[model samples]
Target: MRNHSGHDQADHEGHGGAQPGGLSVSEHGYTLEFDSTILTAGVQPVSFRVIGPDGQAVTEFLSEHDRELHFIAVRRDTAGFQHVHPVMDEKGTWSVELALEPGDWRFFTDIHPVGHDGTMTLGIDVAVAGPYDPRPLPEATGIAHIGEYTVALDGELLPGEPSELTLTVSRNGRPVADLQPYLAAYGHLVALRVGDLGYLHVHPEGEPGDGATAPGPGIAFMAVAPTAGTYRLYLDFQHNDVVRTAEFTVRTATAAPKHAERHHGHHAHH
Candidate 1:
């Protein structure tokens, strides 16, 4: 499904899914392992493990961004959004505990081995039980690059029109330097409608599709907002042991005009 912007609250009243020992989403053979369940608006604990296309645990080999899996929870109608890190039980199993309202929701983990590009992934999904009343929201901006490795965005419907965005990167009051690669890609950016937090993991094309990742000198991506409204943007990059993130709000306008959270909290700098 092309989930580009804000998710409609009414569209998701009830939802659920089940899979154990990992379920396969792509025919190429990648599998997701997790013990999952559907719950009413309450506390939910879940675990996600990455098993390769060959069915082997490949966590240690993943890049700084890949070695550890992230668990983001958003309400189906797109209300509550939380960025969370799962504890790796050993080298393969990772777990997290969260409390959320019901509706059709998504949990995404985009990580890859240092050199395994195409193997990047999103591994979990669950349905929760609730009274199904979503909160109201203002239109959000799609993502845009506010200069200096900084990015922004806003999302709103321009039905039948295309949604295009430009992102620029700079650092320390300069155009940014070094640009080392992390997770086999030149810097990765993922977008999701804030309300539903659906995943729109995207990258600039022409990038090698091999297991090789891309480093950067400033990167930009173009995409179509499946629908439009308010969407949240997340960017991840590694300079060495550290993975830095710049997040902003952006919008998809039918006409001209536009522009857009991470790392305010005590995020351990790698």
Candidate 2:
């Protein structure tokens, strides 16, 4: 397997190999260029392009989970998270509308070039001009309520290991059995480390059309935390033909030490 940097996955064997997200606007010879870095506080249109290693706008990209590009915008205070798909023109420029608020906002573009070896998530921060009152991050919890729906998260996130997470959706104290498929799965999850909003990839356990995967009250996913830290989770699901997102804050468990292996290796050297 290959990492976002086009390097062998082995490089990240014991730790995170790829550069931390939201720290740079470019990586792996690819650049994320925005039309304007400053904007007013309100709904506006944003545009950007991905420059390939050849210094030209990358016009071709493979669709991931039925989307060419996944654009995520979140406030620096871990608030106002939005996940939307942008349409790319022939010139390789992608444009999308966003509801902007005052404060520093981070933009993350998740894409995979047609011939690229692996998926890359490039991010940049933009300034929104206005009175900014940053909100505090909600306490870590396993339950989240959005509108009339309540989502119960059951799972533990362990550092360096894939942890199984199951989210059960309900409404009016009853299980929701008519969950619709979104992004080829019963639910789509995106995890971001709290402090820097580092993008953490969360994989769905199965597909909606798969005979074994049911579209019902429970959605299963495998999430691997890069390190032991607080993470914000955004779960996107569809019901009644409308898409809604449920947010949760979770802290990852500490990684177990490999003490026995280290002790044996130390003795063998003597």
- Candidate that would win on TM-score: 2
**Best by the lDDT measure:** 2
Q: How many residue pairs clash in each candidate?
A: 42, 0
Relative to the unseen true structure, what is the C-alpha lDDT of residue 29 in candidate 2, on a scale of 0 to 100? Answer: 89
lDDT of candidate model 2 versus the reference: 0.80
Q: Which segments of model 2 are wrong by more than 4 Å?
A: 1-22, 255-270
Give TM-scores for every candidate, taking all chains together and pairing residue i with residue i: 0.49, 0.88
TM-score of 2: 0.88
Q: Write the per-residue lDDT of candidate 1 for residues 87-147, one digit (tens) a residue.
A: 7765777777777777766666645444453333353567787567765553444333433
Q: Give a tens-digit lDDT track for model 2, residues 3-94.
A: 33334333432113343344567878889999999998888899999999999999999877788888889999989899999999999999
The worst-scoring run of ten residues by lDDT in candidate 2 lies at: 8-17
